[model samples]
Target: MTHNPSPRSRFGIRFSILARRWRRALDAHLAAAGLTDATWVPLVHLRESGHAITQKELALLVGVDGSSLVRVLDILSRQGLIERRPDASDGRARLIHLTELGEQRVTEILKALREGEERLLVDLADSDIATMLECFDKIEERLAPATDSKDTSR
Candidate 1:
């Protein structure tokens, strides 16, 4: 007889379940405002920058590859939510800018996201939430140095 392993032992499976759940909830919220999670992420980052950002920088910030970023940018541009303009210093490069519609859509989506996040953590105490956020920040900080080191070595 063959023995079966516990599903909880699989970290990827657990993470995938959590990710899908979060994305489903977020996608529903964004859909009400005529947007999807994929559309909102990049736009939110661009809005935060508040200035024209190069395509390379945007791709890095969004944690996606150049080819994938180009597809996302194309979709957003087609929807009139973003524009790609020639870079002032490097004519060969392009800068991505959010349109007014994009800005407004992001504002609305952010509000919804905040609400969704609040709902997700509704059962957790305020102190617990604060501690969770701090832990996440620490994890990011620790990982960032390793990532930088690898990039530099490459």
Candidate 2:
């Protein structure tokens, strides 16, 4: 007898592979500019946040632990990409701010990402993309509870 995976398992495998491939593609495209997913992702998030944010909040946004984010922030600081200042209400809490250079880098990163997306999506129809987005939204909704549970456990 031959073994076969369930639809959920098949979908999971495909999704994971696609995610990894997408990351690798982005990594390759940004390599010349010396921006990896680790460095650029947080910058983009900070730019979009539109306000001062704490280290803990940034770590959550970036999907990394607070300790790990420290190293990344250190690099960004040394490169003049970001600044950390004490929060007004809470002296112990430091708020993360993107420097002028960091904002410029985020713009470049977004442009590169848009170009990459255009190339990848060129063959797909708009309706197909819309349908895919709908399906993804449903999947995300289903996963939200599980995600929340895991976060609470941590």
What is the per-residue lDDT of model 1 for residues 1-154, given as tens digits with 9 covering 90 to 100?
9987776587558767987899898788778867776678899899988898987777777778878888899999998999999988888878899999988878888898888878888899999988968977987898888877755422
lDDT of 2: 0.88
What shift in Å separates residue 19 of candidate 1 from its native position after superposition?
Answer: 4.6
Model 1 regions lying over 4 Å from their true place: 1-20, 149-154
TM, every model: 0.74, 0.82
List, residue by residue over 1-154, the lDDT tens digit for candidate 2.
9989898779988989999898788778887667788899889889988987988778877899999999999999999999998999888889999999988888999998888888889999999999999999999899888877766634
List all candidate RMSDs to the true structure: 4.3, 2.7
Worst 10 residues of 2 by lDDT: 145-154
Candidate 2 ranges with C-alpha deviation above 4 Å: 1-9, 152-154
In lDDT terms, which candidate is top? Answer: 2
What is the Cα-based TM-score of model 1? 0.74
Backbone clash count, each prediction separately: 0, 0
